[model samples]
Target: MRFSIYLNAQTPGPQEDVGIIQTLARQAVEATRAGFHGVVLTEHHFSGYNTYGDNFMFAAHLASQVPPGTKFSLAVAVPPLHNPMRLAQQCNLLDILTGGELIVGFAAGGSPLEYAGMGRDPGERHAQMAHNLEILEAALAKKPEDPPLEWETAFEHGTLHTRIMPSAFHRQSPAFARATQSDSGAEWAGKKGWYLFSAREKPQALAGRWRLYKQALRAAHAEEVVQDRLDWSMVQKQVYLADTSERAEAEIRERLVLMADNQRRSFGHVKDLRDAAHLKSVVGVSPQNPDEFLDHAMLIGDPASVREQIREYEAAGIRHMAMLFNFGFMTPETADRSMRLFIDEVLPAFTG
Candidate 1:
């Protein structure tokens, strides 16, 4: 399996945000040097959910520093928020910059505030995303001689008379991935022979998603596409490494609670993850209750145990693991220690 770091940082307040963002940037450089195969980023805006709101620009900056082999994924970007032409141009340019080592994942959904900030209606996001994506595909496929497109939407409309300049480095346009928590990720992306990923899911439970996607791909695509797309599937986790499980748990205990409280305040008890009542009944842990959330949502242990957890994920068809080392108000220095330990001890078990 190939492992990568998911570069996401939390903001406790405006006071602490700047330092976290700087740390996150340095962590990207450190991770590439530490021998991770790739890196993943998510696009979040307005709420400080991601320390940086501009993933495309951040990725371009990273491409200059990370090793040539260090691939990148936008794991996702919200399509409805961008002008289609600009979005297409940005994706193609970034793809060229990465030497075609880019996967542009997209989803229709985003936070309501983000939609509002972009002057897009949340209720119309799906339609808007579809419209934007169609334009993007058309723009990517356009040749200089092609006729102009006349596009209109609720918010804006324009004509595109020329092909998107500086075409993608890849011959067949950039590889596309979809981000979704529902079966649609497989039903659409799988059948279309595209990559798909999800987060906040149990690694073991992802076996179901894997099976469904494989079934869908086998039914719709040729052998080469099926074989190539089948491997390198992604799984995300929050990771912390220590000499012993006891030490790992004790070190992360308070931080997890603080993170959970943010989730409760930001997302209203994180009902989307699961309400307190159902979470307690099914998993014996509330969404904001960090006591057992650590066990369920994170990968925390000694190097040996961490390696074993990764092995389980591999058996379940996860070839790409995107781990988050800094989270829940954790210090950069502390997270880097875990990352370096992972590189020196745990990674060799998998990589070598």
Candidate 2:
């Protein structure tokens, strides 16, 4: 099993932005020293849900400071909001800067407010994301002889002939992963040989999705493609460790509720019940008690208890666990303590 820090960088308000970035940077350095595999940065905008509006740029900056071996995972970049050529160029530069330590995750963003703010239609995001991804892949794979990529869309229309200079340090390109909720998304990812990114579902539900993904992979490709098993598939979860379970609850319980409320406010406009259910499964509903909230949704407890929870995920065939240690309005000191405790007590158990 491999562990990665999912950097939320959430603060109480803009007043604390600088402090939050410093704290996240400190933690990233500490995580590298502590033998963690990588760090995952999120992308969000126009809300307190997260503060990183341009995770790729932030990632590039952070990657320069972290150790050469520390990898970067873009949890999910919203491609529809970006020009595919520009996005690919920036990603390639980041990959080179990190010494090939980059993994790109793509997703059709969920927040309607964010879409509206960007002057884009939320309903058209899926198709737009698919199209952008196609262009991005082609741009990355383009050679000097290849013709310019020509396309027309509501947001962008032009011919892009410039190749991504200093092409990705990786032999091919950074490993590609896609965040998926529906069966079709899983099938698409599998057929394209991309890794899967999922969270919030129970182990049984995740197992079913993996099965479907594999079936699609087998259907679309040969036996060799289906036979390769890597731990690239990942799941993200909010995790906080303390000396005791009670302490962990006390530190993060209230903030968890606030986080849930923020989620509700941001995504409450979706009229479709199925979409609502999916959102609920991922973001979760507000819980009456801390235990109920942490039971299946998060990993919050003492080191021993947290170890047991991770064992369940490992058994479920999930090897990459993106752990979010800071969220909501939790203080940086509290987040730092939890991370240190996790590094000293919990991480060694798995790594050793």
Candidate 3:
């Protein structure tokens, strides 16, 4: 099994804006030193959901500071809002800078407000993302016999006779994953033989999705490819560890509520049907009990309790878990403290 820290750039207050970046950078370095396999950064725009609008740049900065083996995962770069060619170029540069430790994931972004702000139609995001993926895959192709690249979309129109410059240090593209819901997106990612990432879902639900993804992969690719990539999946969950369950609950309860409230605000404003459907799958209805919510949604407890909870996931055949430790307006100090305790007590049980 592998573990990763999912880093979200918190919305800093005006007075704290300058220092927040440095704080997050330090946290990334700390996570690396704490023996995490990788750091995954989320991307969001215009909303206070996240501050990392350009994850590639932030990842490159972190990569420069960390040792060569520390990997970087771009949780989900929105494809519809970017020019495919330029995005490929930036990814290549990041891969080179990180010594091939880059892992890229793409998604049709969920926020209608974000799409509106970018002068795009949120309803068309899936279609646009499909086209963008084609172009991106073509731009990153390394084989001489790969098909010629051609793209004609609202965001870009070009044909590349030559492969992208600064080829990835890896034999193929560094690594490609897709952020998928329990939707057609999972099947599409499986067809492409890409990795899978899901968030805020139960083990049973994720296991079902993984089964679907594997079935699709077998139908779309050779058996060898299917076998090699079947287990390259990750699930994300909010996690906080402390000396006691009571302490963990007291520390994270208010923040968890705040995080849910933030999601309500963002998802409540959805006007597009597609975004509404996505909101239904991700946020569902508002919760009445904070304790119940924490019990169901997050991993918050003492080291032994958290370890037991993670063991359930391992039993369900989950090989990678992305822990969202710095979320819901958590202070840097608290997040760091939780991470250190987890590293000291809980992580070794899994690693050893």
Per-residue lDDT tens digits for candidate 3, residues 1-352, read 7888887755645565456667778878887777888888877777666766678888888888876687678888888988887888888888888888777888887576677677777778879988888878777874556666778877558877767777777755778888876657689778878888877666677777878888898998999887656545787778988889999989787786776676666666665535554543333223335665675567889999999989888877688888877777777788888888888998899887
RMSD vs true structure, all candidates: 4.0, 3.3, 3.2
lDDT of 2 by residue, 1-352 (tens): 8898888865567898888887887888888778788889988887667776788888888887777788788888999888877788878888888888788889977566667667777667779988888888877887878888786665987776767676888665777788876668778889888778876656776777888888887888877756542366778888988899998878677777787677666666544423443434333423434565676568888999999988988877777888888887778888888888899998998898
* lDDT of each residue in 240-260, candidate 1, tens digit only: 999898999888887777766
What lDDT score goes with residue 283 in model 1?
Answer: 17
lDDT of 2 at 95: 85
Candidate 3 lowest-lDDT run of ten: 279-288
lDDT of 3: 0.76
> How does candidate 1 fare on TM-score?
0.88
Task: Give the winner by lDDT: 1 or 3.
Answer: 1
Candidate 3 residue-wise lDDT at 90: 81
Give model 3's TM-score versus the native structure: 0.87
lDDT at residue 318 of model 3 (Cα atoms): 80
